[model samples]
Target: MITIIAAIANNHVLGKNNQLIWHLPADLKRFKLTTTGHTVIMGRKTFESLGN
Candidate 1:
């Protein structure tokens, strides 16, 4: 099963300058809990945003 996770704004904005425009603690917790122990996949930009 492949599960893709992302956050899109109402204006269809995904991110800016390789970083998220907003922060939500609950969302973060959910993401962590859901993706934990999974083989996470992400785009190059998203990886860069995490300073990888």
Candidate 2:
């Protein structure tokens, strides 16, 4: 299966300033666990968020 992970802000802003608004360690852990040994999928916009 494919897993998709995304981070959003309180104002429902996705990819603000081309990046996530906040960083949560737990969220990262969950995403890692969920996608472990599995294929991941995302859009170009999502990948671009990694820059900032």
Candidate 3:
């Protein structure tokens, strides 16, 4: 199964200045649970934005 998951606001604005504007812990938990044990792919910018 191929599922595309995204967190977007009503305005369809993804991010500003390559950074997320809001912090949602619940969303993060859900994302972790959903993609657990699966190979997730993301762009370079996205990967870099989520720093280690």
Candidate 4:
């Protein structure tokens, strides 16, 4: 089973100007709870966006 989780805005925009449109705490919590210790998959741009 592939459980896909994502946040899509009303405008269907995932990002803009290299920043997240929404930085809600609940969203962060959900992401942490959902992907913790799990093998996550993302595109190159998404991976690159998360700088070290």
Candidate 5:
């Protein structure tokens, strides 16, 4: 099985100026829980946002 995760904002903006709009602790927890023990795939930009 494959699982995907992404962060979105109220204006339907995934990213702006190559950054996240807000930080939601609940969403962060959910993302961590969902991607646990799994591989995550994303664009280079997204990876850069993670400081990878």
Candidate 6:
């Protein structure tokens, strides 16, 4: 199964200034649970943004 996860704005916006514009604790928790024990994949920019 291939699932793409991302946080998008209500205005249909994605990011601003190369950074996420929204922060939700519940979403973060869900993200962790969804990716746990899974081989997560992300774009180079996403990894860089995470300071990896």
Q: What lDDT score belongs to each candidate, Candidate 1 first?
A: 0.84, 0.71, 0.85, 0.83, 0.77, 0.84
Residue 7, candidate 4: how far off, in angstroms?
0.9
Query: What local lDDT does model 4 show for residue 4?
Result: 88
User: Which parts of model 5 have CA positions greater than 4 angstroms off?
Assistant: none
Q: Cα RMSDs of all predictions? A: 1.8, 3.5, 1.4, 1.7, 2.1, 1.8
Per-residue lDDT of candidate 5, residues 1-52 (tens digit): 7655767777889877877778788987898788778788878887786763
Candidate 2: regions farther than 4 A off: 1-4, 45-52
Collision pairs in model 6: none
Q: lDDT value for candidate 3?
A: 0.85
TM-score of each: 0.77, 0.59, 0.80, 0.74, 0.65, 0.70
Which pairs of residues collide in candidate 5?
none
Ranking by TM-score: 3, 1, 4, 6, 5, 2
What does candidate 1's lDDT look like per residue over 1-52, in tens digits? 7778889999999888767879998998999899888888888876676663
Model 3 C-alpha lDDT per residue in residues 1-52, reported as the tens digit of each score: 8889887888998788887667899988998899889988988998887688
lDDT for 14 (candidate 5): 88
The TM-score of candidate 2 is: 0.59
Give the lowest summed-lDDT range of ten residues in model 2.
Answer: 1-10
Regions of model 3 farther than 4 Å from truth: none
Cα lDDT tens digits, model 6, 1-52, are 8999978778989888877788788987998899999998987887787673
TM-score for candidate 1, please give it: 0.77
Clashes of each: 0, 0, 0, 0, 0, 0
Consecutive 10-residue window with the lowest summed lDDT within model 4:
43-52
**What is candidate 4's lDDT per residue for 1-52, written digit by digit as tens?**
7898778799899888867788899888888788889988988777797687
Model 2 accuracy (lDDT, Cα):
0.71
